[model samples]
Target: MKEMTKKIAVLGAGSWGSILASVLVENGNQVMLWTNSEEQAKELNEKHTNEHYIHDYTYPKELITTLDLKEAVTGADFVLFAIPTKVIRPVAQQLLEVLKELSIKPILIHASKGLELGTHKRLSQVITEEIPEEYRSGMVVFSGPSHAEEVANKDITLITAASQNLDNARAVQKIFMNKYLRIYTNTDVIGVEVGGAFKNIIAIGAGILHGLKYGDDAKAALMTRGLAEISRLGVALGADPSTFMGLSGVGDLIVTCTSVHSRNWRCGNQLGEGKKLDDIIQNMGMVIEGINTCKAAYELGNQLNLTLPICHAMYNVLYNDADIQEEIEKLMTRPGKSEIEKYDEC
Candidate 1:
């Protein structure tokens, strides 16, 4: 697949989507960025800047933008869905309609991180549920610690390309890997997706700790314990426990929890500072994944009868209007248990 000119369709013009489109264009692919916002499409095409998303980053002049979903996806070699998780199923359903018209099957890749609200399905699961089998050749997940802001700036970054099919994962890696961007292949799709989605929940907790003025020691403890919590759930769901130690798991958790670029962390910081959830959402004007993920994880924990105290605490803060301090105290005061109780299980 080296030096092959492929037509790539990037769904969504959010920061992550725009950055990916730019990278594909840089790699000499024919790239089209699809956005529902007519204004954003115009800005991307004419101004070559997606200021609303990737701040101060100029898109490649060769990159195109279209408001028409069908036009963006028509005859694409690979279709990367980088939209919000809430709309992933709807987009996949719409893509099915487009595929019906074009009669084309392209490799499917998703960079979105979050579970579906009601169904709690992974993004790939949502795509599979909505899109017919004939319309997509393969599905892969592109995730890790890489942030859109840094990626757009051409900072050195590493990401995971995960699929049950190793060939598909490598194909994705071949297209995306360059000097500044590195890609690794993995077979554990469940662990990768689970880690990517669940880390946002822990990131919010990290931000809350930050806002509460908890020092580095407290933050370190949260991250470590958070990894344990994530690994337990991932293992329970049939993911390789070691995947939590990989790039998509602990790696992603570290970046999202500590960085200012993380929307989830920012939302949590606001919450810790005594802002209302509604106000935080309104002010950010972006999808803070952890808020919704918290709900899903809370429900899932209840269904699975798993003890996910940090997730439950965050859920209480967001949904139950519980005081953050009281919730933290509750978490801290929980009965002692072995540190690696679930470690051997994974």
Candidate 2:
């Protein structure tokens, strides 16, 4: 049996981070749940609860929460980064300060999605740059059809653990899977990342449909076609086509797109309801990844010169103040073409 005495540092103490922390504690590992706020750390360390981010959820009494970066990651076998995508670079930069001082190298697992906007760098690329070169490959992405709320409630869910190394992928799979969570291992890091990474863009579009009071068939078609666009981009990025069909790909897209609890979906719905982009973001105190993804995907789409009509429409609506109804009408009148292209005829 694999050793279970590992110390795992989970950054971001959100619902997803808390759920995973609970699982690690259950697995006989020492868990350090890190937070940016000292107040949140107090609640988590003293009350065994994270009422702010994860409502009605109580962490294990033994689970440690700290504001100190060095303390949170000290001697841990793995560092789980569940921070928001936009904050990833800044947070990783801060971690470098701690790492440079103490010099500990543990496997860094990122559960965040959404590509970096200006850099157009994948999350993996960002992580590699953050960690030292010799330890660069010690990275993993925990991705799949995981909804944080459901995970906090101990719901049975599936996720894919991906790394460049097959052995490391299996190790990550074994570490993350619990009775309530099933973990699969994969080697297609880019495909797995992009599958979970890019689907938020489409999920926002799904929410827009709900706000528009569209029929279920309309939503389903959008999701299917949206997946096609994502697959196209992923292929161009050197991701395996088959990865788009796996748990992290279509599975995650379906759940994120359909669920009312999805922040991205909710953000899109609010936009579709005619709220201003700035207003929607201001009201949504939580991180809605789709908006960030929209910016990055739009910029990246232009960089790659790829045709992503759905993304383009959403970007225009979110950033350019384009009329949602008008954009939908425009998409409806788009030129006809095969849904499955020769490039990615899967």
Top TM-score hit: 1
- Candidate 1 per-residue lDDT, tens place, 75-107, comes to 898999999988898889899999889999999
Clashes of 1: 0
All candidates' TM-scores?
0.98, 0.96
lDDT of 2 by residue, 1-346 (tens): 6674888889988877877888888878899988888888888888888776677877788898888889987887788888888888888888777776767777889898878878988897897887775543388888999887898788899999999888777777877777888999898999998888789999989988898889899999999989888889999899998999999899999999999889889988887787777888888778888888888888887888888889999899888988898999998998788765854433
Q: Which stretches of candidate 2 lie over 4 Å from their true place?
A: 135-137, 344-346
Cα error of candidate 1 at position 161, Å: 0.5
Superposed Cα RMSD, model 2: 1.8
- Which residue pairs in model 1 clash with each other? none
Candidate 2 least-lDDT 10 residues: 337-346
